[model samples]
Target: MRPLFVIVALSFAPAAYAQEISAVCKYEYTVHDQGQKSGTTGEFSLKATYMLPVGQPLNVQVRTTKAPCYEFLANGDDMQISGTCSRAAQNMKMVYVYKIDRMSGAFEEHFSINDKTGIVHYGHCLPAKPLL
Candidate 1:
């Protein structure tokens, strides 16, 4: 009876710990862009959410009207969260890279289209309330 009870408890322990290791971070960014051809500058607000799962790639969902969710593999871990993803659209390849400091909440995002056009976003992030 004692051996059976011990085995059962040990089996359940890993699942509990895995759940606790998952994290979600929400961020709001001020987008800055200068027109490549027109040389016009503009600014706007953007929101994004990042989900990090244990032993798996992280995912980011930008809160835009028509943006697709992007997946990013673990890049580095020097006291920060960082990832990169790339996709092709309209005959152009796009790359996105982001990093957030764990202590200062400072966030930076870079988006490049075919290595020709690029935009950088700067902002901060905090733990977000879980959605019901």
Candidate 2:
């Protein structure tokens, strides 16, 4: 599952979302070509949930990366979280980057591994099954 879409999920955010928020969200996703200027490989219907539990690190299970990451929150308009996932046999590593824009309610995420990268636009925020 791609956990990248948690960025724009506030499409269903609560009324008080602008000032504060708390929830586990699964976002709708569309796959864009990593670097090629042409067609996309395919679409990912299943996405991972993302969360920032107080006093704990950010948590999510991404298909591309397995490492846990930490979220960095600033009081203003931006937030970020990132970590790496690796492939032992290939000796490759993918770095996942998740970003949120509070002012615009925009979410963005991308990861690069094995020379391929992907970015997904999160469409909405709704409750989803917790990652185990």
Candidate 3:
């Protein structure tokens, strides 16, 4: 009986160390435009909330916004952006393509920008990107 008890306890111990749900992540990004030859920068922030369950894919929602510019909503595997500050030649709004992988934390975030377009993009995804 003692040996059987030890085996059961050890098996459950590993499960107890798993990541938890209700994880919140935040990320900030800055974009610089070198083409203008004027050195201008744009900034944005992103927040992600999600749950992590063993043997289940992480579920998450990503929200990003650039003050006086645009806001975006990304849920699960879908990404969408809307809102505009002005009606200029350039499209005030644009959609981004991305994917998420499981990592250590329940939630994860990153800041990045397109080198050629000088488009600053920042956001968080979950259940955090895989470390490997």
Candidate 4:
């Protein structure tokens, strides 16, 4: 079975202020086969909320937090956040990466640890868009 520690469910409050960021996005995807063509595949359905202060660096030393965020100039929907979350005190450390681009309010979050060696695709479908 795949390690499930990567899954994090965060409970957040509604926008504390207009610039106080908070959003809940639901994604459904299949468990990716990490280049092992002989293994059986499974699926994952999860709901996660992305939160932070608009245009501010997120530093949550407790569990996990976003570093900072920037979006595509051509369109504001595309974004990426780099961060790190520590577990079991200082014993465990993991760097988290989040990337997503949504045309509308709908969004799909793709997460990977350290690198892209293993990737899972959620409902990341968007209409064909030309690159700038």
Candidate 5:
């Protein structure tokens, strides 16, 4: 009886511990591939939310190395993102709706343009560290 009880308790612990950590952040990211003969370069300003094992929903503004790269803002179900695509020589902006899943801890994030509808999909992006 004791062993069975221990197993059940342990199983539920992980779900219980999945608390949320929230913070407002700002970061700069650079994407460049030298091997490619022709590559695109730009930056983005994004407001994001993630599930962290600490407090609330993490919100952030991310920018690119280039000026006017991109910008994103979110308020509940509403999200607005804008930026310039220098390689294509096109200025683009978008506003959309997003559902928030508030949880806790560092989770892997995948980035896409216009809900994964575009010529290219920017894959894995790491969280930026603050400078000293």
Candidate 6:
């Protein structure tokens, strides 16, 4: 039985390695406050990277944010991926939520700072290319 146990463990060894999901997403967004829209619209891009391991919460890093990392939750299926990230600082709080359709690369994002400011973004993401 010891030999059988060893074989079973070896079979699952490959899955124990870390997995990563990385993407470069671009957005065209408008700022809003109190139901009023800003006169200017802008475009921005963010790079999101997540390190996922079995039996552990995802470790995430997003570029173009004040914080290096945020608390994130993911709800994903075969067709779509959705998640939210939130961070807080002295007397201020920020939240960002996004949904991406895996097939078409379409995505929507909402970012809010405190209670009074918000921005809505619409765009697409593609897999990130390696720097080197």
Model 5 Cα RMSD, Å? 12.3
How do these models rank on TM-score, best leading? 6, 1, 2, 4, 3, 5
Question: Residues 23-115, candidate 3, lDDT per residue (tens digit)?
Answer: 123344434444222232343344444333323343433344533323232334222112122222353433243333223221222222332
Q: Locate the minimum summed-lDDT window of 10 residues in model 1.
A: 14-23
Candidate 5, residues 12-129, lDDT tens digits: the string is: 2232122211222222232323322234343322333322322223232323332333433322211221222322224433322222222211111223344443232232222233
- Give lDDT per model, in order: 0.47, 0.38, 0.32, 0.30, 0.28, 0.53
lDDT of 3 at 98: 33
Full-model lDDT, candidate 6: 0.53
Which is the winner by lDDT between candidate 1 and candidate 3?
Answer: 1
Candidate scoring better on TM-score of 2 and 6: 6
Tens-digit lDDT track for model 4 on 72-130? 11111124322332223254333333433322323333344444444443443222221
Better model by TM-score: candidate 2 vs candidate 3: 2
Query: Could you list the CA RMSD of all candidates, in the order they appear?
Result: 12.6, 9.0, 12.9, 13.3, 12.3, 11.8
Q: Write the per-residue lDDT of candidate 1 for residues 1-132, one digit (tens) a residue.
A: 676545433422332112311223334444445633223233223333334333344533333221332343433232455666688878988887777565444566678888865776665543333331
2-52 per-residue lDDT for model 2 (tens digits): 344444344323222223443243345545655333322321222233443
- In model 5, the runs with Cα more than 4 Å from the true position are 1-60, 75-118
lDDT of 6 by residue, 1-132 (tens): 676445433422233223234445666544555555544334334443444543444433344332433334454433455677777889788777777665555677778878645876677665554321
Which candidate do you rate higher for lDDT, 1 or 4? 1
Q: Which stretches of candidate 4 lie over 4 Å from their true place?
A: 1-18, 31-94, 102-132
TM per candidate comes to 0.51, 0.37, 0.26, 0.31, 0.24, 0.54
Residue pairs whose backbone atoms clash in candidate 3: none
TM-score, cand. 2 vs. native? 0.37
Error of 5 at 112 (Å): 12
lDDT of 5 at 90: 46
Of the two candidates 1 and 6, the one with more favorable lDDT, higher being better, is: 6
